[model samples]
Target: MTEPTSRSAPADQTQKEGSVVMQLMKHGKEVGVPSNELSSANAAADQKGQPTLEIRKDYMYRSTGRPEKTDMIKSLLTDQDASRNCELYLSASSNCSAVESSEDSEEDMYRDAEEIEREKILLCETSSSEHKVSVAPETDIMEYCRKEWRGSTPVAIRMRKGYEAVAQKFASIRRVRGDNYCALRATLFQALSQTTQLPSWLRSEDFTMLPENLLSKYDWIKQWQLKHRLGRKMGEISDEIKEYLMLLRKKWKNISEIKGPVEKQEACDKLFKNEEEEYSLYEALKFLMLNTAIELYNDDKDGRRVPVFSWLLFARDTSSNPCQLMHNHLNHIGHSGGLEQVEMFLLAYALQHTIQVYRLYKYSTDEFITLYPNDPEEDWPVVTLITEDDRHYNIPVRMCQETVL
Candidate 1:
């Protein structure tokens, strides 16, 4: 909001990434993955030289699925009326909604504030060595949750002097396993957890194939899609996607349909065994998230719009690609990026009042810094904690790590 500070990606790097579906449609080509795109992804493209779904133009859009651009323009009743809400979008299609939205309510205010539009994907290295990357114990990330940045020590004194107010407001630090994707997984975990309440409309349908544990995840995806009008932007889904979605529905319902957990897992494995579908699902998920970001960033009312910082986010490197980051894959070196400490929190959190993160960098001289800060009255709740080692892994080296499309 305050010119986005240095935390934001630079203007040139923040160029809009068009439609997520259209961009991914490019990879659907037979030419294979391009090198420039590879630089930002962790290991989404597999060692087998295959993408999740070899998307084709025909599958990207259906003539009957939705109207063409001309028809859409002609159908509009009034050009003077530009205001549109989520329901309006769910009922009708509109590309104009990608970067526009109305004023935020309390919940949306929280959501909008963090929707600092960005998309720079990155992945972390997962090696068999089992050598932990830092000296700090995993549990140490929790210390700063309750501890104030205080004391006579220089770093502590500086934190207290500069950020005591916002630093003290954070609830608690959340620690997710570093085995892989602590950033994305943890963020999704919180988002899914917060979205646990099932809408009554969703309960009427039979999703007997999904595992009981995953029904909520599926529903949350649907709920989020409609709530954000993403379904409309995507137009009518293809029969193949619909079939795949149904297959997934059946597979997930199988969790409850089957008698035992072991049998259930086996059934689930059978469903997900297809590497192609697995990759397709991953890409599909990223596009859905991309849609959410674009829609929220475009939200406008009375000609005023809250700008998101960038769709992609990274600790030090500004040029990361989120689409590549979300996919899980192992490289020739057997290193998997699926479970690394990528800055996945960006996926869950969006433009908001102010969310500050604090790291206890035991390894550095200026060990403590106010990563995010805001007035409580003006901003939503804030802050997350990490160890010095955690910060090290989050920095620039992994951006240069070996892994190509």
Candidate 2:
């Protein structure tokens, strides 16, 4: 034994080998592996006397420990400064594969274009009320120009024309009622009467009775006709016929009263049960009577004046004071200047009898007081005054006389 070749040499060599294995184990742990598993696997490989070169299976070590080995390999392959220097090579290979696939797909480009064009034509030919027409994506200006030139009407324009025609027809139907023309004339007469401060005599009596034809001939009628044409179109009336009939019947009933006051009052109650509704009838009757009275009062053509007093007496058959009735009629005329004189005359006549009675009473009482004031035992002589020839006369004797005071 060449001095037994120092047993330390083999021991040192074993230690060096173990250190290299530890270094590999440390590297595996650093790259995310269990340190104990890495060490045990390396020790087992060493015990089998396997070539350390075969034991250093980097791929095996990486795959055995990692769930994301493929991802790690991809990352490593993409890195520019990677020790393997395979990033550029892998990138070139992937690029070439993509280019080949693109070329293969390009072979059907013309066919796809033809299919798209067919679809567009099919869509354009189809007409549907439910589905709205829409412009094609990426449409060229020339395509829009061609479509516009074809006179394919827009939905909005067609709808507008249809509505306009309907409106014209509706307007034509409104004229048949004759209310518009009549209302305008009524309004004009009312406005003029109010503004001029003229007596109601100037206004028409029973103005509602004015003929529609007569009202239609007014100047304002022409103005309204120019502004808006009347009447609705044909065929639209049937839908509204029931309502129109009801309105016509109502108007007819109002115009035709064939009943006495009791029957009329009952009818009025049936139609208008509320007191507020009666106000309209009251106002209408008041206007009618006022107009009639004014016309009769102002009429200069007749030689004989219509005595409103006679009318009042006719209305009230019982004994009514003529003076009071005349005064009321003057009040109704509502001319202050003329009313004052009538009022004064009525006032003078009202006090005349009372003044005479008071004067007679005072004279008789004074004479009696002068004759018998101091004598308590003597009975006073009674005095009586009688109206004869518009003068008061005193009676010296008081025999069963009754004084009406």
Candidate 3:
């Protein structure tokens, strides 16, 4: 027979086909298919002039026993160029998959972090809303005392007896709400009560007490009114302070003019019970204290003496500078509950009244009374303050015909 006419693809087509074969062999090796089987598939495809894809599928599904086909496969595996190209292709593909997976992981991490931040913000807001201080109402001292005495101990018996004696002295016991402002509130309440009892003649600016004024009032008001003057002279007092003083004067006049004892009491209760007016009065009292402190500082400087204010200031903090101390104590929002014994003395001198504090202990009712001025002459028009704990003050209504200041 005539030599079978050799048939082959064009050189270019043959090169492309070779490349495809090489790729198939590389893929088969990666997927754990035997090299001999891949070689068999390729050689069989060449012999039959069949498609590479059909041969590969056939070889993959059905194992090959053709030993003669292995030479081409061994040659392809040993070829350095083919091995390098296959490795490079596989490495590039693996890198692309790794990059995409890393990007996806990075995205997941960011999403988790953002979710955590949102939770933190929500938690802080919830905490702030929960901790806000609620308004406290004034309550009876006996109710508190009853709770105290209910405990059947020796201390309880002593406390019960002491409070009973106090209760008999006063018609009623009204506790000032315990806060930084308690002492000031109790003192002001007593002052206002005393102010209400004063005759319009004595309340006037004339600084003169008539025979009629004297007849109407106790000897104490005569002295208290005569001594009472503005914390600073007229020129030195600021307009803002003037307004506060005038407002207080107006409150005194309005309360004094009220018809009956019950109505007057209601008016006073309403003023203190309302938070708005209560804080306004606190502002006034604080400003007054600051003003007094400033005047005292200036006077001390002029006299060329070591200031008592400086001593108190240095004792409390580093700076003995009056202005620095005043700014720190008065202007700071967080500096609540700083009104000390010295400041109480300042308030007493500023208001021109004696702040008499009668302290009751947990164990005993033995009165620990303190007067701000500590004058030998126990002054009338005194603000009678009672405290169970020395920190907070309350008003005890005196039983006598004399109105409690």
- Candidate 3: residue pairs that collide: none
Residue-wise C-alpha lDDT for candidate 1, range 15-132, written one tens digit per residue: 3322222222222211122122232221122111223221111112133222111111112213222221101110101111110221112113222222322101111222333233
**TM-scores of all candidate predictions against the true structure:** 0.29, 0.16, 0.49
Q: What lDDT is obtained when candidate 1 is compared to the true structure?
A: 0.27
- Give the alpha carbon lDDT tens digit for every residue of 235-267 in model 3: 322334445545665676788778776677768
> Number of the top candidate by lDDT?
3
Listed per model in order, the count of residue pairs whose N, CA or C atoms clash below 3 Å is 46, 9, 0
Ranking by TM-score: 3, 1, 2
What does the lDDT read for residue 236 in candidate 3? Answer: 22
Better of 2 and 3 by lDDT: 3
Ordering by lDDT: 3, 1, 2
User: How many steric overlaps does candidate 1 have?
Assistant: 46
Tens digits of per-residue lDDT, candidate 2, 1-405, equal 000101112222433333322322231211111112124343333222221211111211232221111221222122223322211110000122232343234323322444445545744565442122111112222232233223223422332333232232222111000111221112111222122122222222323432233233332212110111137453322223223223323432452343454444344334333323322332232223322333333331232232222122212211123322333332222121111111211221111111111111122222111110111111112222121101112111112233322
Candidate 2 global lDDT = 0.24
| Native-to-model Cα distance after best TM-score fit, residue 266 in candidate 2, in Å | 4.8
Better of 1 and 2 by lDDT: 1
